[model samples]
Target: MDYDGILNRKPFSTAKDEKKLMYGEWLTELTDYHRKHCHSYGQLLKHLMIPEHSHMGEEEIPMLPVGLFKDMDLISIPGNKVFKTMTSSGTKGQTVSRIYLDRDTANYQQRALANIGGDFWGEERLPLLVLDSPDVLKNRNLFSARGAGILGFSIFSSRICYGLDQDMNLDTERIQQFLDRYTGKRILIFGFTYIIWKYFYQALAKSVQKLDLSEGILIHGGGFKKLEDQSVSAHEFKERIREVSSIKEIHNYYGMAEQTGSIYMECPKGHLHASLYSDIITRRGKDFSVCSHGEKGIIQVLSPLALSYPGHSILTEDEGIILGEDDCPCGRLGKYFKVLGRIHQAEIRGCSDTYDG
Candidate 1:
């Protein structure tokens, strides 16, 4: 299906009613497409008794549990057509989720991400300073979430520099050179949350050197389980980052490997804003019923970008609460929410914290 109509729309421009109509048609089509192409998914729909061509509201759509990808090869495309396989980060001996992407789906992901990032960072491509080592991308065929994140966001950068060495140590000299080269210019910095806190922020805190990134915008995601253990709140993370570098703007996004590009980015108001490409709904654990605004429940992420797999609507292990819709003080039009971390005792599978590399 052609996605130009939806992709062309401004990231957060569509209001709730219009977005519901637009996304409803596209997502319903995607549901039928996946049910026909993927045998396992077809059986799942059959078992759930959701008839073919059924037009259901966003919350009424069937959501495959996110963990299913860890146990099954849930690709809708033929094997030969697979362009890339993305794996979620996990500790040693833990099974990771595998997300298959065909060329078209992958392209859509890139385009969608570019559109969303453009809305926030502007159209100009700036110099990018990645917080991880370049070696993480050595295995191009299969990517961990961290690797894919770096590659995906690299589109916003005119020149890219790796701030960490091969051993995951902060390469201060390399970072300094990168800063010097882009002095007095706005640059982009990307990294996983825990990695930035442990390697970049803490490492810088130990040294007498203080780098200047007053003109930089930092985008970070991947769960905060580790930092939470250290009692590091989001506010603290931003304040500490300022102590290390003069970077002023920091955004904490929420996304998973299952649905990569259509991330929920945090607005200036500290709420995670869902873009036009995706939507968010919270469900009570006891019955999976939709939750009202300000009520915390399991987060169900809905996106139409996962054409290569049955991942369009997924019941994530994470918990969150819908703060508001179409009325954020930031003026973005869409549902804004706050992630309340993973469900109790859910496997610790955030990109940075789980990645042993």
Candidate 2:
């Protein structure tokens, strides 16, 4: 498909308020078309055969988790057009798989970043301080930290990386140098939680130079899986970052390689809002019963941008509660939800292994 032309069909350039209308209608129409085209989806729809009228009920979009990406013939593009494959970092079973991403995937990823992240970063060229390992991008492991941001998000900017230290540590010298060089501008500091905490938080605690919070955004996520093991609460992480940097607007986004087109942005109140491109619903308790607003359950996410893959509305392993609707005081609209935590013993056999969705 000529994705460039499809994306350029007047979606992003329109007025800001129209995004939800355009995105919602387009997603619904796209999924209706997508359900008929993709094989796995077609099979699922045929097997269970949800009524034609029950389309927007947040049904699980038939997606083979990253682990099964190896086992199935999941490619949707013509075989000759297949480009790069992005894998996940998780326990590698005998059957491991990589997500086949065509140029369209890159296009979708770039557009989504520009539309959403652009709202946060704005037009100013912020000197970036990437608090991550240099080697993370070099190798091609599924859990490869470095490649994730570069491929999924950071390519949207031109700023360079101030990676880990010479002793393979979180190099404060490099970050400091970048900060010193790029003073008087809002900085963009990106890293996974543990690394950012270990490096910057530890440094701040030790009386190192504090981050200028008045001028920046700290975009970090790699799940709280490993971070919580260190006894760091989400509040503490935010507080410490605030204390060290002094930035009030700290956004923590959540996404996956399975469906990289949409990112769930965290509002200041600590709830992640579903983007215009996707919507979510939760199942109450252990029963897969669709819960009402403010009820806790599993998050089923739906996005229509996947062509090379099928990740429509997927049942995630995380349990969360929908706090409210588009009435956020923070100016971010749409269905807002708080991720309570990951469901225990949720046997999701795949590379994308965060139950806390």
Best prediction by TM-score: 1
**Runs off by more than 4 Å, candidate 1:** none
Q: What's the lDDT for candidate 2? A: 0.62
Residue lDDT tens for model 1, 1-357: 668877887999998998887667778888999999999999999999999998877777899998899999999999999999999878778898999999989988899999989989998999999998898899998999889999999999999999999898999899999999888999999999998998899999999999999999999998788898999999999999998998999999988889989998888889899999899989999999999999999999999889999899999998999999999999999999998888995877666635465
**What CA RMSD would you report for each candidate?**
1.1, 4.7
User: Candidate 2: worst 10 consecutive residues by lDDT?
Assistant: 348-357
TM-score of 2: 0.80
- Writing each residue's lDDT as its tens digit, candidate 2 over 164-262 gives 653446565666677777777777777666667766677667875665646667887656666666777788788888887786667777666666657
Q: List the residue pairs that clash in candidate 2.
A: 61-313, 88-142, 88-143, 89-142, 89-143, 165-171, 213-245, 213-246, 213-247, 318-355
TM-score to true structure, per model: 0.98, 0.80
